[model samples]
Target: MSAPTLAPYVFKRPWLRNLLNPLANWYANAAGYRKLGLRADDLISEENAVVAQALKRLPMKENYDRVFRLRRAMQCSITHKLLPKSEWTKPEEDVPYLGPLIAEIEAEAKERAQLDTLTVVKNH
Candidate 1:
């Protein structure tokens, strides 16, 4: 499950977004995933049921791409080298490919839980 976040609140305030944007960018760059040719979503652990489901639900091409990125990252890690700058994942290319799927799965689970506990009343 995703951690609770103040992202919505932070995003709603222009000043806050402006203030944090640079720091966020700097942190992302410093995280080194992009240097290894991996997107932010690639760093999400698959140990969670939600993430695992999301991964399984990924489109075939996207799944293939995710696998390729992961393997490439692993190889780079093993070799103790980063991808060339030209091939490093650009900030714009680091979108959350698996996040929406995970959200959808979580929503479905919530709905199912609600439905499972729903009570029906008899009408006179």
Candidate 2:
């Protein structure tokens, strides 16, 4: 069978919303893969573009948690930079190694959160 054509009303269908929720950002980001680069600029460009596409597609999905996860991902990326893998194990207890991009992500996350809140209010 074909995948259902997406529409705003699709979100009102509980089963459809449940199935699509967790996979929304993941599916978007998984599109267009490329090899990682040794240079920092190349990596940043690739990663940011993937994230931008995922974020752009977020609003079209049928799930709230997908939006929440994306918001949290943006917040975490802003608050925490590329620390060693060991740091991920103790993230809650450890201080994040902040990077220059933190402010931008934080601002974007804040804006998205406000928009989400408004969406929820409208749906009520």
Candidate 3:
């Protein structure tokens, strides 16, 4: 499950978004995934069932790309080296490819749960 956050609230406030944008970028850069050519979504842990399901739902090309990024990142980690600067994941390229899938899976699960417990009443 994703951590609870004020992201929605912050995003709705232009001033807050503007204030945090630079810091968020700085933090993302400092996190070092981009240095290894990994996107932000690639950092999400896949140990949970929801994430696993989401991964399975990815399109063929997207799944292949995810695996490629992961393997490349792992190789970089093993070698204790970063990818060349040119190959570092640019901010624009670091989109949340898996996040939407995860959200969809979660929404489906929630809807299923609600339906499972649904009750019907009939009038005479």
Candidate 4:
């Protein structure tokens, strides 16, 4: 299971969120993946079974786009070149497409485990 995140706690406070939002954006931009046309979610490692299942559930078009993005990013990396500005992923376009599905899958798995281990009490 993933460790708990402080993000929601910080996000709940308007003052903290306002203070952190710019820093978060700056960090994301400075990370440089968007310059290669990859979204932040695209940076997630795909080798895990949960992620694999989540990937399989993606719409065909998004699945195709994801593969294309990864290949293009790899090629750019090998060539030591970034995509042209127009091709770079814009902030608004860099949304999490796979994260929700992965989280859903993990939640379902957790629920299934809970059900499997459930004990029923008999009332006669």
Q: Estimate each model's TM-score.
A: 0.95, 0.21, 0.94, 0.93
Clashing residue pairs, backbone N/CA/C < 3 A, model 3: none
Give me the overall lDDT of model 3.
0.92
Root-mean-square deviation of candidate 1: 1.0
Query: What TM-score, to 2 decimals, does candidate 1 have?
Result: 0.95
Write candidate 3's Cα lDDT for 66-107 as tens digits. 899999999999999999999999999988888889889888
For each candidate, the alpha-carbon lDDT, in order, equals 0.92, 0.41, 0.92, 0.92
lDDT by residue (tens digit), candidate 1, 1-124: 5779899999999999999989998999999999989999998899998898898899999999999999999999999988999999989898889988888999999999999999999999
Candidate 2 — worst ten consecutive residues by lDDT sum?
32-41
Tens-digit lDDT track for model 4 on 3-122? 478988997899999998899889988999999999988988888899889999999999999999999999999999999999999889988999889889999999999999999999
Task: Give me the overall lDDT of model 4.
Answer: 0.92
State the lDDT at 83 in candidate 2.
Answer: 33
lDDT of 4 at 70: 95
Which candidate achieves the best lDDT against the true structure? 1
Model 2 clashing residue pairs (backbone): none
RMSD of 4: 1.2
